[model samples]
Target: MRAVRLSVVTATAAVAALTAVTGCTEKSSSGSGDRVVEVTATDDKCEVSKKEFPAGHVELAIENKGSKVTEVYVLFPDDRIVTERENIGPGTKQRVTAEVKAGDYQIACKPGMKGDGIRQNVKATGGTVAKRDPRLDKAVASYRAYVQAQADETLPLAETFAAAVKAGDLEAAKKAYAPSRIGWERTEPVAESFGDIDPKVDVRADGLEDGQEFTGWHRLEKALWQDKKIGAAEKTLADQLIADLKDWQKRVGKAEITPTSMANGAKELLDEVATGKVTGEEERYSHTDLVDFKANVEGAEKSYALLKPVAKENDAALVTELDQQFAALNTLLDKYRADKTSYDFTSYDKVGEADRKELSDGVNALAEPLSKLAAAVVAK
Candidate 1:
């Protein structure tokens, strides 16, 4: 469910920043004296206030002056994302906080949220980031284990779904589909960090790149449900799907996991629910969005629960809000399922407009507080 609108350049080219300056001139500091890099994103250019800063927590104060919704990325020289803030609407402002090691990096702004973004070379210089709370380190370790476990579990379920597809048993494939996706949906942010993997394994038809072959779950999904025919091409895709998943499973342990990334990733899951599952764009044919939706919430909750000890110590009120909102959202979701413990739920197509609105509202309410989690967890 990644909206990978941009094609990444090669490692060397991705490190080179475009030389264009039409925005903020000098660097500034927040009232708390943290390094603040002001980013002005236009339709054709991405301007950063300063190209260098001390390594630790840096805040990107971004304003999208473009005519379209934009996305900003803090990327490794190899185009691996460190952290990102997506869907920044025209004329709106957003602030993203990220931790960085001392190294060369690029800040990319994707205007219209497509193609390789305008890039700027930036450097995180020498500075001692404060010693983190030991619990935060433990939280990261626990989350990493959770991510790998999800990846490990998902492959077998996906294999089951693929086996059914290869056999041309539509009913069996349909039965396996929702169960197969639960693990992936739960850890999508970690999975998506691989850059090359998500598009191959999960990309929807509309999210496809130019001339990109449709060969992921959605492609096979269309074959099973929409096209209502499983042929040679679909059989091939089913095998390819398992192959891609295996690649993801092998690479899962190497993903970058940090406290802020986990917090940011938790929020990203809600964004997924809001834009894809809730809108019925994801699982459009199968109407199994509720299953995916539940998984996203569970994933977010897992991260929050791990971080709660630190977050509560830092900002008790925010934790209170998160607890309430999570409970409320989970309760709301329960109404759709007759068997509360199972994945089975009323098909999304059977849900009414009013019910969808309530769901959307629940997500938005939780997302607002959830977005503050990174800052809270990192607070002294």
Candidate 2:
């Protein structure tokens, strides 16, 4: 559902909330440590009570002292976020506990959730903490459950969407299009296990080989929105989409989802949004890029959540960072949330370039930390 790795320059350019220097509700999977550090955040500063520690399981309490919204993060030497907390409005608070090795680290704060905030160094004097999370297996199991739920949800929606299209009811089909796609987007890694089915249904115009017939969603999307009509061929395609989705549901039900692949799937889904949705390519005719954008985020979020407990066991700071980043990104996407389920956004064609750039930047910021999720969760 995502992938990202932000360089120092890239982090500065996109800003938003990220990195370490905050605290929160969740406890590290590893037992509590003797170390407790308090960090306070101002609009322009991240102040830590201590800069050096023995670094086993360290407790961090990050409070927003700024008048505006703020976020905190722990960053690696490479400037990647190790942990973070977001949207501490006014005087809210967050906390985290993490295990670490003896090394140089940085704490970055984003005030107003804009740009990279101030970064301060943190030192760990002890050797690396060992990885031994009992929850690791449960994490993978939970992710499988989430995928299964999405798959089951998609079955009926797929039928409804395809049925409307086959009936030449463009309006009904358009209405059904988004929800049906949500299940597929969320369960993509599994659904894609079907060699020919995924490409047949999900492949975009860019993936279309010469003389290869354009089929699937985009193909039908054109018929409904651009042409504003559906013909016999279009109806036939709708039926095939249904069959493909059904087969996908059946096959994916028997598949295994590992921690790394699930994490990778989440990252890939975000890539779909960054490259296609942000650029206004997906659902071009309807300008419903945001719809897919939101769905992709849901998929990625569930994946990260599944791996979170184990990640916390190894690198609580990273778990915190991911939680905050995901929240910030979801909040960003929620701006488009019109009702309980849908977005209020118009097509990208109607959105200004600056706004589009902002969206792209935000996506990149989240992607950076998200890319690290798999490795963090699966480490032994």
Candidate 3:
């Protein structure tokens, strides 16, 4: 089948609104020492008339006033405290009492539901609540722009990969191949819409470079670039790679798009490369792959960015928990760059089993935090 390219899907306006309106409140109660806050959730979203609260022992009354099943959760900076009420039907209100510290926080609803997820900033001010920060809006905008810019750069990277292969520079080709592969992989979700295309048959394995039979795109590039005699065989190889590229572009344009799907696709493509399974005559490295990888990284960045505002606003006990996960992912990327060959499954032993295990463990460490974050986003 023709390889699929990956692409990112943007969030809708409705989803944005759902997340914007859910506020938190802290108010003086009848008692002398503590405060009481009333939080409500509608089928569509959550609401708190007041957006700020005081840092101290507080009682939060979470009410479900809408018709659908819903939930209300208060996230702490440390991610250590999460209070939730499930299956609160229409007109039902459940009270969850918890001690909240003074700081910034986030109120979330529908933990795993899709569309119009609810999230609101909660600021604590000397036992009083405050308004949302204007700076946060700007930060979100900046992040979105950054991701889109990375997406725009994919096409040029693909072309560079093609050129590197044509030039017969193995070293350059290696670098070029990564970006192109990453682009296609990251765009795979959207590419799926084009359906599957069988690999072209004319791309053969007969060519040799430096007396060695070459396979896969990298091997093909080596032969074409190193071969001194530019003849019919070279032309055939170049034509095949071009055809593959066209096929890839066509498929990637049509599939459903999402950052998670794109990231998964990039991971798969990288796996294929490491395993030496990508085969076909028309294959050439494309710079687009690097763009796709960057896109995936941007997706992770978005998740991280979203958490920062939430952490600062909510004093969620888990702030450090979330930050550590993002840091681990960054470390993984750094290691990958430091030794691309380390990802080669065939050569795992060369990197040492211990190192490989460390990499594996690091990725696993991200699963819970990512799932929690994704759940927060999808829930809305």
Candidate 4:
């Protein structure tokens, strides 16, 4: 599927509403002094008093007057340096201080929301204010909870979708598919975990009543849904669909294992807060898991690009190599997950450090060469 560019129309509407309620004036903080920026969130939008601040330490005071959970993100041009406040629940306020350099900057809110996207251009003058948002701690807690709930909801939905297909109930399957998709769609941060399953195939069109029947597993589902007879042809199609789903499940499961497992471990650590037992300090490798997963993804993406034409031409060698690469990565990920969960963090100080280091190194090794191969293949 083609990637859709994010729209800022909702953001504009949000900004307008915020501007009106706050009655705040925009001023130039470009001089050699600390500046105070006030930002507020409303039901329909987020508003900032000013767009630009001086190039220095700037303090942002964020207040949540809206009924829903709101977050404020300050984005740098590089896209890496970001400061965000999450879950500033209604009637709450938070503040964060960031060192601002003289460059283009934006203050954006409700990043993933459809009609709540708001961004304001800010120009920093000179000097900076070093203030921290007291509400940030709570916001992080709220965000973590939100992510956990989303994961819990998504897993079961995927299972149900598979069951719907197994039962040969197209209508039931169609209803089930959307809720299952919501789990993944709402959790956009982990959307990349699904690997090469085209969104167009799996999520968007899988259970639709549309007349167009595509290829792969979804086509099988369409056959079961539209075809009335449960004869040899249907059975053959169903069997093929099941086989394809199993393959897809393996890939999707592997993708979920690394990130979801890490998240699970992290959640356990957070849960242990009441007991004051933060085990696996160095052993916890969430960051490493993400890095490795990203590398594998890049490699797979590369191999796909390179092998597409060859596979189309019925080049067995290219297809075989691609399969091997995917299988190897899949095996590595499985082993890493098993190793990670083997040790009881609470029992040992080192926890899974050795295993994590090994996994990290393995991922790094795979990502580099795979990326190169994929780039070469695509180039050819």
Candidate 5:
């Protein structure tokens, strides 16, 4: 329960012992450099074997010595999560590798897998300067431009949706909702970068927001589809949504996007479909989940498109598999499109139970291969 002070020799020996016991070399097991950091996570805190290290490739072999399920994170300045592992049960160990830049960062241990997390500062000093791969640099530039284009498209459509709501035109507002959301969904990471406005723009009605009034797309959907009317109160939320989106456009101008992040984003969008869309929780009121599903896939597809060149060059077989999976998954979804635009999109509710299961299976199939993309891109 007390703070631990592990000497570097002890930590090094511990890792070496672990390597011997598992019959694995540290570098091979972690895809990390020889430098290892033992991060011991407990019920309420995290203990680092080393308070500092030279910047570059590092691995944190996390030992969850906690009583409950927990997650741990290596954070950049201002608490941007760099890499994290979740759902580590009691007495389990998980390894997370990160290519860290020279800076001060924090270790966050969330004992319950939810919270701001208990944090402790750690430093990375000068070392062999980590150089960016030109391919990854090119991918990052392309992804950023995509986000900018999506944002540029989103603003005006948001205006139309907001105006329709203010005018009490439920039919028109409903028409505008899905299209407006496409650009926003494609730029999910950008929405997240703005912090305060993300939930306001996209939070589902679920209690996840800690009772934050659920004033986003689902909120507007309820007013439009369920109530069949948009009152002044509903119009206020619409105005705020547009306001937040415009703010996101400005803030995202300086935001960063990396290949690893791109891969994570793609995986996360698929995860969203599996966890939320399939369950119908996200589109509880309007059953607009098919719209969300399509958008998530589109966003991920764009990321994959950027990585395609590097992926093809390095792991041509894997790229071919992913390409095939994506095509199959899209073919499965194209069955539900009644037309070319969001205007004629089919609701997830219209699909029979069996058909929905088929969609879920298809998404998982793509996600299985898609999950390997980030590593391939990084390894390349």
Candidate 6:
């Protein structure tokens, strides 16, 4: 959802390796120790400190020295994402911690947040990744089930939206739009892990690559709400949307899910809300930003709930803060709707600037504490 361009690979090629994480650890020529890699991103180069290091808990200390927003990725040979941090704004620094086994990988930086990005070959030499808590295992398993369920539930709803689009029923398609997006909004990072399907199904008009045709929900959304007609082109795009999503449905079970990734992904969801939903950039035509906003919160909360047990045991104070912040944000969101349980909220455009500022503040409050979740779960 953060507009990271990864359409270079065909969807078929992307789904070829459904599993992103490997169980086997390679023997490292270098002995096991903590590895911290420094990355400097500029307009033209991706500078990684070391090309090879022992694998285990590797931390990327990244600084965006460039003038434009950038994204950094640790990718498998096949371009499957190991872990990534997107939307690294200009002149900002972020530290990302990921567990890796011995393997060959590439560290890439997309200066303008587009294309395959500048790449450098890096190797995780033989080293053992430390064992995780058994409770963390349960968290991973439950989160995987939750991710898959969201994917399963999404396809049917998307099909309903596509059906209306195909039938040229403008009103029905409009009504189905926000509902179809809920599941995807909740589990977007899982969808994005594939590196191909997201661009196919969710790319916005401005997010398109050079010579890439725009054909997704937003395209259809534009036609229905802005262009005011569902013509043959719209119908064809509708079919494409469903086909792409069916591919996503098939691949959700194979995505890489870890406690840290869940925690990281939850933060990414909040970033998504802050950048897109809060700014009214997403759902620009339909004015349904609040619906997507709610879905994003729901997805983040689900991940937090799964990891809460271990996190609470590790850092009770952080857990308490997270709980308080989440409640405060939810309470703020609830004011937009008459019924708290439903997705039917006031359109984003109708919300005043004062209200939008409050929502933004609420997201920041929760996100600050939520950022500590991964470390909490990984604590000894």
TM-score winner: 1
- For model 1 the local lDDT of residue 319 reads 99
Question: In candidate 3, what are the lDDT values of residues 314-366, reduced to their tens digit?
Answer: 44444567667657755665553445433222222234456545644654465
After TM-score superposition, the amount by which residue 328's alpha carbon in candidate 3 deviates from its true location, in angstroms, is: 2.5
252-334, model 1: which lDDT tens digit per residue? 88998889999989998998999898899999999999999999999999999999999999999999999999999999999
lDDT of 6 by residue, 1-380 (tens): 77656654543443332223222122222332347788888887787777787776677888898999998988777777777888889999988777678888778788898877777667898857677888888988988888889989998999999999999999999999999999999999888877888888888888888888888899998998899999999999999999999899899989888788888889889989988899898889999999999999999999999989988989999999999999999999999988888889998889999999999999989987876777787777
lDDT-sorted candidate list, best first: 1, 6, 5, 2, 3, 4
**Higher-ranked by lDDT: 5 or 6:** 6
Number of backbone collisions per candidate, in order? 0, 24, 52, 20, 0, 2
Model 1 / residue 274 / CA error / Å: 0.9
* Alpha-carbon runs more than 4 Å astray in model 2: 1-134, 340-345
Q: What is the lDDT of residue 140 in candidate 3?
A: 43
Instruction: Write down the lDDT of every candidate, Cα atoms only.
Output: 0.87, 0.69, 0.43, 0.42, 0.71, 0.84
lDDT digits (tens) for residues 145-242 of candidate 4: 54456556655665676566667666665555444433333333233223233323332242232343343334444454455323445445444444
Query: Could you tell me every candidate's TM-score relative to the true structure?
Result: 0.95, 0.63, 0.39, 0.32, 0.80, 0.91
Highest lDDT scorer: 1
Residues 1-380, model 2: lDDT tens digits: 21111224443432333344343122232323446667777876677777777755555677888898776666666554444445567798765545456777666666775554676667888766555364766776777777778878887988898999988898999988877788778666555533346656776665554455677887888888889999999999998887777777776656645565676667767767887789887777878888788888888888887777777787888778778877877777766666645555555577788878878988888887776776676555
Choose 1 or 5, whichever is better by TM-score.
1
Report model 6's TM-score to 2 decimal places.
Answer: 0.91
| Residue range with the least summed lDDT across 10 consecutive positions in model 3 | 1-10
Return whichever of 2 and 6 wins on lDDT: 6
Candidate 4 has a TM-score of 0.32
